[model samples]
Every structure is written in structure tokens, then in C-alpha cells.
Target: MATPRPFSRFEFLIAWRYLRARRAEGGVSVMTWISLIGIALGVMALIATLAVRAGFRAEFVDTILGANAHTTVYMAPQRIENEFTDDVYVVPGRFSDYEEIAARLAEVPGVTRTAAVVKGQVMASANDASNVAEVFGISRADLEAMPRIVDPATSYGELDRFDEGIAIGAGIARELGVGVGDRIRLIAPEGARTAFGVTPRVNAYEVTYVFSAGRYDIDRTRIYMPLAEAQSYFNREGVVDEIEVFVTDPERVDEWSFPLLAVAGEGAQVWNWRDASGSFLAALDMEDDVMFVILSVLVLIASMNITSGLIMLVKNKGRDIGILRTMGLTEGSVLRVFFLCGAFTGIIGTLAGVFLGVLLALNVENIMAALNALTGGGAWQPEVRGIYRLPAELRAYDILRAVGLSLALSFIVTIFPARRAARMNPVEALRYE
Candidate 1:
């Protein structure tokens, strides 16, 4: 039974012995350790890079979906005459039967919830500045249900209590130098055409809550108000501009959106969240892809070290190779042995790198915090990074791909030196010894 085991251990045993050679036997080559370190660093960088990119994308998607609905059903744009300016006024038409549409959308397979909304653009003014902002008129119930990624401590509960209370984004609040309990003026463009030269509808709303939602654009330009007040203010009572639909699976937005569109018929326009942010998301994806390609070059450079180290190993063990060849070891076996030695280095390096990468990715926030604390809190700044913490999303597929790519390269690079050793003249190799 022990005699039969030699065949199974043949290549691996030789490779392991060569790797463990003592200092008297030329020791472990410095190049071998260098190759291992190189591979480890390259693999770690690739894993960490991919994880951080994924985290950023995931965080952005969640923030966007939380502030806005998964799918929105609104009226198609229509052209009309503007009495105020005698110009063509193209506007988003309103849907009067929003309740019916909401009810039908709720019955859709993937649809979980629906809320009617009145959305419009308005001019907002505070003590510090005046800016144009997008306004959402939502029911108290829907407002409560909408996720608040960033909450205002002083005014969080004020929205439900006051009819004229409004929630404004962080950017708007900052720009206006206003906070909870402050007042802002909202002016609607489509005011009644009275003999008094078309008075714009103006209303003062007390800032009730401030939401950040982790997005600067949304924070800069969004205000949420009660649906009833918004309907009255916008002069669209008993009608909502759109029905916002929440789905069970946001990834399958089309499945949820098409059914609502079909129920709402021809005058309806259904827009998924993807359509609104496709370009931004695409740019992020492309950046991740490009970064992956660039980082892979580091791994390729590390693989070259393996090639060099293997070439050195073959030269140093020329006599050993000749002895093995005379002892019934075929050229194929010799090649396999050298390949195994290099593969061992890659495998070990990759495993260590993966472990280190996962640890770093999972605790990046803590590490950054520690770094800041150690450096007196100025070394790592969130304001400069445009995000609060480093986001890391460890994906299994990405890790596996990185490891496979590194291993394949390591194996291929070993082939050249391995072949040279395998084809050596056994007689000449032993003559020097």
C-alpha cells in the first residue's frame, strides 16, 4: 500500500522539498519571498478596491430609493398656453383618478405600496438666500413611511403636528441658513390670473424636519409638504400629479412599472428609478471596470516575479533535476513539479491576501476612525471624501475571479522555466556535480 503512494506524491513531494531547502542548500531564495509578497499585495489591493466600489454603488442606490419611490406613475407632458408670459407652457399633466390608479397598482404582483403625490417647482426664500427647489406633496402616512436616512432631532415630529410644517433637504437648509423651527416662503408660478396682474401663490411654511438622504443634489433641491396643503397651494385640489409605487423587488422595477402603466392607460407615464439615474450609475460601473483592469496589471507584475524565481530554482537544482530524470521521472513530471512550486506561492499568497482584504473591507469605517483619532482627527476627513465612511461591499464572485486570475497567471508564467528544466541534458547537468 505504501509503495503505491509514491505515484500520488511524486510531483508535490519534489516541489515541497525544493521549497523547504535549508540555508546550507542555498536556503529559501530571496526571490521566492519577494514573489509571495508581491502577489499578496496585488491581490489585497484588487479585493479592497472592488469591495469599496461596490459599497459606494450600494449606498447610493439605497439612498436614492429611500428618498424617491421605486416607480412613479405620472401624466405625460403636455403643451399649453401660459397666461402670465404669453409663452408656450409645457407642463407635466395631472391625473385626477390617482386613487383608482393607486388601488390598481397595489394589486400588482410585485407592488407593495402606493401613494399619491403632487410635485412641482417653487421658489423658496429664507433670510440667507433664495433658491428654486423641487417640492413633493405627500400624505402624512406616506411621509412617515418614507425612510429618513438623515433625521432632524428638533423637528422630526413636527411634520405630523402642523399642517403648514415642511421637510426640507440639508443643502437647502444650509444654503438658506435655516433649521428646525425656522420659516421659509414658497412661491408657486401658476398663480391665479386676477385683475391684480396674476398673483403668484405665496405661502410661508415652518421648517419641521430636515432630511439629508446622503445625496447632495437631492439635499440641495427637495422640499416635502403635506399633500392637502400642497394640493391647495398648487391649485390642484382633488388631484395628484403622480402615484408613487413601492415594489417588493426594486431590481425588477419593470415588472412592477409596466402593470401600473397598463392600468393607467395611454395618458399615463411610468418612470422607474433607473431611468432617472442611469447615466450616473453607468459612470460608476465603468469606473469600477476600468479600475479592475488597471489593478490587474499589478497582479501581472507580481506573476513575473514568480517566473524569475522559478528560473532561478531550475538553475540552482540542475543536478537534482538530472538525478530525478535518471530515477524514472519523466519530463512531464519534472515540469509539473516546478509548476506546483510556483502555484504553492500564488495559492498561499492569494489566501492570505483574501483574508486580509475581507478584514479591511468589513472594518474600514473603524480603521478610518482610528486613523483620525490617532492623527488628532484631521488625517481622514469625511467632508473632503464626500462621504461619511469608506463603503466596502465584499462580493464572492469578485474575490473568486481575482484569485482565479492570479493563479492562472502564476501557473502560466512558471511554464517557460519549467520546460527549460524538463528538457535539460541529464548527462551534462550531473557532470559539473
Candidate 2:
């Protein structure tokens, strides 16, 4: 039948009255609008910056994990020394039953795909340019699944033929000034023993395709050859170095790793995506935290604007405050009234800013494209960044956290000024009249 009003309602009403009041009515001060704008801009900056940072990390991780497995099961490293040769030692281990292990991994509930991989480093020479490249020997199907590190239009027919050709990154192609049908020489560091001494193993492979994984480092330094070819080149026939496993959920590495590890059996050591890329992800996390801290200083500065506005309001409303205090209004209530006035600005500005920031984050790619169109291209360079467009990923947690921090700082900054207004002497305040 009736609506009950709380102290907060009364405080909000007074704060609203002050906010809408004209110059003649001693309402809405100029500083209040300034403070509101300040808070709005600060929150907007924080949200947009954090969103971009998050997108950068997500895109990078996706690119890396797309071409690689979520987890790798490999034979543990062991030392093999030859007493007769005195200088012969081998630390790189290979496991045999990889096909069985892969089958077992595929049977796991969360496992999506499994493959046995042969990886090695070799010196690649095309024309005058020679560079060290990470070579992966994988099946045709798996190679297609990898991030098209080169133009897909480029013919890769030779890749289907065992030991006939190799796929190189775009970087390798550029540096070597070579393309499809070019011949590249691969020299493995491991060698076979001859009558006199050990000789370096060498082979020439036709370049069947070129890929661009969109990562500059990978595009320039990686190569792909058939798994059989890799094994033959590496002198590990009928054996794979590791069984790579992919899971439905890459984020839950710990959960997926266990079942796959179980399926891999003994003599196999497992490493998840995080195990290989943890340091890189950790660095991104640290940078995100640092950016948050730095941007928060803007909000703190905006809160100071809130403090200034409230202090001015207090001086202008001295007589009103005195009259209210004389009418049995408590000092705590007076303090609340002013505090609510400042808090209202912080709340409104923060909400507005967050809304605007979300819109910006969601459409950042289109926005960049539009900018490029207007600026006659080159505004956003994919060639420079290796990404086709700008990335902006908005997270709800980041928005809420920024809003909370801004409100807390705004609330805290209001205290000193609100207290002074509450403690004013009624007699002295009205004596001026």
C-alpha cells in the first residue's frame, strides 16, 4: 500500500536536488560537470586499454596453440654414451609404440586429436640465403590443420609425396628469394661415421609450398616435411620423438593432461601447452597488471575532481546546512548527503564510460578498418604487426573491477570534505546572514 523510503533515498534526493539546481538556486556547480567528465574519460581509457591487452594475449596464444598440440607425450631424455668411441653421446630420445599411444590418447573422453610428430633443427639453404629452421615432419591432414603459415593458394602437391619436398615459411621464401618448385638443401647436424671420421648428413628437398602463420618469428624460422622423411633424415626410422595430443578445451590443460599421460604409459613424459609457453603467458599477465596500475592513476585523478566539486558545494550551501542541522538533522546525515552528491557523479560517469568502452572494444576491428579507409590505407598495417586487424576483447571482470576501483577511490576522496561540511558551526554559518 505504501513505499518505504530509506536514509539512502533521502540522501540521494538531496544530492539530485543539488545536482539539478541552477546557478541562482545554488545548485549544480561547474566543478561537478568537470569532475563527471574526468571520471568518464578515466574509466573509458582503462576499459579500452585492458580490452586491447587481453585481445593481444588471446590472439597470440591462439596462434601458437593452433599450429601446436595442447599436450605432448614424449620419451624422457636419457644419456647414451659409447665407451668404445669415447666422444659419442646421444641425449635426444625416441619412443617406439607411438601409434598405440596415439590410439589410446584418442580414446580419452576430452581428447580431440592425436598425432605422432618428428621435430628437428636443420640448416636450410636456398640460393645465397641460409637460415636455421625448425622442421616438423607431420602428416598431410595435420599439416592442413596448422595455421596456414603460407598462402593457401600456393600448391603443396609435393607434400603428399613421401620424402620428395618440404613446405617453408614465407620468411624463408623471402630471404632466399625462392618459391614453389625451388630446391632447398637441408643439412642435419647429426652425421654418419665414415672410414676416416664422422661426416655431416645432407639432403636436398624441393619446396612444394610456403606458409605464413602470421607470426614473424615462426613464419621465418619453421619448415614442414613428411613425418617419414623427418625420421629418415634424423636417422630415427620406425620411431617418433613424441605423440602430440589435442583436447576439446585447451584452457583446462591440467585436467586433460592426466588422462593423456595415463594413456601414454611409462617411459613417456608429458608436457602441456602451458609447460612450453608459461613464461610467455606470464610475461603478458605481468604487463596487463602493470598497465592496469598505470591507468588507474587516471581514475584517482578523476576522484580528486569529485573532491573539489563537493568542497565547493559545501561552501555554497553553508546556510542550508546550518538550517538543516538546526532542524534536528544529525551530522552523520549531513555527511551522507554530501558524500552521496559526489558518489552520484562517480557512479554516473563510470557507468557511461563502461558502456562506451564496451562499444569501442566490440567494434575495434571495424573501427580500424574505417580509419584505414578514411586515411587512404596504411592506418592499420597487418604487415607490421603480422595480424590482419586490430583485436579488442572485452571481459566483464575487467569492467567490473575498474568500476569498483573507481567507486572506492571516489567514495574515499569524498570523506575529508564531507566531514568538514558536517562539522560546521550552525551559529557561525547563519551569522553571516
The top-ranked prediction according to TM-score is 1
Residue range 370-424, candidate 1, lDDT tens digits: 8888999786554554444567899999899889888988888888988998898
Colliding residue pairs in candidate 1: none
> Could you tell me the lDDT of residue 279 within candidate 1?
93
Consecutive 10-residue window with the lowest summed lDDT within model 2: 148-157
Q: Candidate 2 on 11-65: residue-level lDDT in tens?
A: 7788788777576744346778888888888899899989998998887787677
Error of 2 at 59 (Å): 1.2
| Clash number for each model | 0, 5
Provide the global lDDT of candidate 1 against the true structure.
0.83
TM-score for each predicted model, relative to the true structure: 0.88, 0.83
Give, for candidate 1, the lowest lDDT window spanning 10 residues: 148-157
